[model samples]
Target: MTMTDQRRKEEGTLASLFEAERQYAPVPSGDWMARMEALALEEQPAPRPAVPAAPAPRRRSGWREALRAFGGWPAVAGLAAACATGVWIGIASPETMTTLMSSDSSSLLSALDPASGFDYAMLGL
Candidate 1:
């Protein structure tokens, strides 16, 4: 049908539904409250018996507990990477350590500058 006919039909159906709903008067407040109280009483759990305390959880190994107590795998990977970097700088290349330590601030800045075309691999650091 046309849009206007469809709209009129929908409005009529909605009004009839609302009228049907309105015809049923609500339960009295006193009756409803009493029913709700009765239902609540019926649904209450019976008292549970007191039981012995649960056994203590098994203790994990010191390192395993420490790992979990701290951040887990991501923290571990970060620490591993930092240690590896430290070891590489300390033992693998003494020259790199000296160069980094001896270099002035300006040279450090130049190394960081992308426009200067600073090649880290070429520096052999």
Candidate 2:
């Protein structure tokens, strides 16, 4: 057949297919929609019951409260560090402490009695 004849035949087939689609409009019934809604609600999870709140905590006193005021254990550790540093310096010092602790009359008496015109710088220390 000619090309014109084939094009006309295809156009007729498409026109009839669209005409048949326009003649029908399928829709769900009211009872079907109600049933669908009811099914949706039934498929949902159940709600949980309400729970009671827990009781309040007890109050702290005496040493426990005092410890909190001192910023807990870390502050105590800092205080211990300071005390240790002081003790270490006092024990490890060689020059001033050694001269001060000497039982010799001149050195000990001179270091104590600042009125004796004893200048620590005179020793070239």
Candidate 3:
């Protein structure tokens, strides 16, 4: 009665007619299926080759060779003397020693006199 029902009925009638005329027999096969499968397998590419590993390099003995070439004991003594010279110059310099000596208690007490109302009790001296 409705347009959709009429359309569905028409479709079913057409489908049944087509089914009545259709073949129900199995299709005959050829060697084409086997050939196609063989061709597909043949067309597949082969895997790539693996890369070769490199050899490990030799260890160095250059540091020992250099120390032997320079005469190791003399080289060590020269380095120690250079370090001692630097320390001696740092400690023996007049300006550095004067600054160190001026930081002593006697210098601090001389800077503040007893008659100058300087609070020694506050300094805990």
Q: What's the count of clashing pairs in each model shown?
A: 0, 0, 0
Candidate 3 has its poorest 10 consecutive residues by lDDT at 109-118
Candidate 2, after superposition: displacement of residue 86 in Å? 3.6
For model 1, how does the per-residue alpha-carbon lDDT over 1-125 read when each residue is reduced to its tens digit?
A: 99867765778868667666778967679988999999999999999999999999998899998899769989999999999999987777776546866899767766556745346557754
Candidate 3 lDDT over 22-65, as tens digits, reads 65645546787788889999999998898898888776699877
Off by over 4 Å in 1: 1-48, 94-125
- Model 3 root-mean-square deviation: 19.7
Instruction: Give TM per candidate.
Output: 0.36, 0.29, 0.24
TM-score of candidate 1 on Cα atoms, chains taken together: 0.36
Q: Please provide, for model 2 over 35-57, each residue's C-alpha lDDT reduced to its tens digit, 9 standing for 90 to 100.
A: 99999999999998888987888
Model 2: colliding residue pairs: none
- After superposing all C-alphas onto the true structure, candidate 2 shows an RMSD in angstroms of 19.1
* RMSD per model, one decimal: 14.4, 19.1, 19.7
True-structure lDDT of candidate 2:
0.79
lDDT of each: 0.79, 0.79, 0.73
